[model samples]
Target: MSTCPTCSKPATADFAPFCSERCRHIDLNRWFTGAYAVPAVELDDVDFEEAESATTPPKSDDFNA
Candidate 1:
C-alpha cells in the first residue's frame, strides 16, 4: 500500500496519497495558508546576456592557423 504524503500512514483508496479526508484537508489547508511554497530565483541575480555570452566561444582571431 502507498503511504500518506502528509502523515506517513497507509494511504486509503479514497484519498490515494493521503490516509483519510482529514489528512487530505490538512494538506489543502497548508497550501491555502502558504505553508507550502515554490522556490523562485530573483531576476536581479541573473544576467541573461551574460549567461548567453558564457555559452558562446569568442571569435577566432586568425582565419587560419
Candidate 2:
C-alpha cells in the first residue's frame, strides 16, 4: 500500500495518495486558502507590444477589405 500524503497513514484505493476523504478535503482546503500556487512573472505593456509587433503582419494600403 502507498503512504498517505497528508497524514502518512497507509493509503486506501478510494483516496489513492491520501488516506481518507477527510485528508483529501484538508488538502483541498489548503489550496482554497492559498497554501499552494503556481509561480508566475508579471509582464509589462512594452513586452506585450514588442511581441505583438514581431508576430503581427504589417497592414497594407493596397489591399481593400
Candidate 3:
C-alpha cells in the first residue's frame, strides 16, 4: 500500500494517495499557491522567432480560393 503524500499515513481507498480530504486539500493548496512548478528553459526573442517561423506556413500570392 502507498502512503499519503501530505501526512505520510497509509493511503485510503477514498483517496488513493492521500489519507483524508484535509490532506488532499492541503496538497491542492500547495499547487494553487505555486509550491509545485514544472521547470522550463527560458527562450530569448531570437529563439522564439526561429521557432515561430519554423511552424508558420509561408504566405502565398495565388488568388485561387
TM-score of every prediction relative to native:
0.65, 0.65, 0.76
What are the RMSDs of all candidates, in order?
5.9, 4.2, 3.0
Q: Write the per-residue lDDT of candidate 2 for residues 1-65, one digit (tens) a residue.
A: 78988899999998988989999999999999999898987779999889888998867964765
Better of 1 and 2 by lDDT: 2
What lDDT score goes with residue 12 in model 1? 90
- The reply for model 3, stretches above 4 Å from the true place, is 57-65
lDDT of 3 by residue, 1-65 (tens): 99999989999999878999999999999999999999999999999999999998766754353
TM-score of 1: 0.65
Best by lDDT: 3
Name the TM-score of candidate 2: 0.65
Where is model 1 more than 4 Å wrong at Cα? 45-65
Q: Residue 34 deviation, candidate 2, in Å?
A: 0.7
Best candidate (score: TM-score): 3
Any runs in candidate 2 off by more than 4 Å, and if so which?
51-65
lDDT scores for all predictions? 0.88, 0.89, 0.92
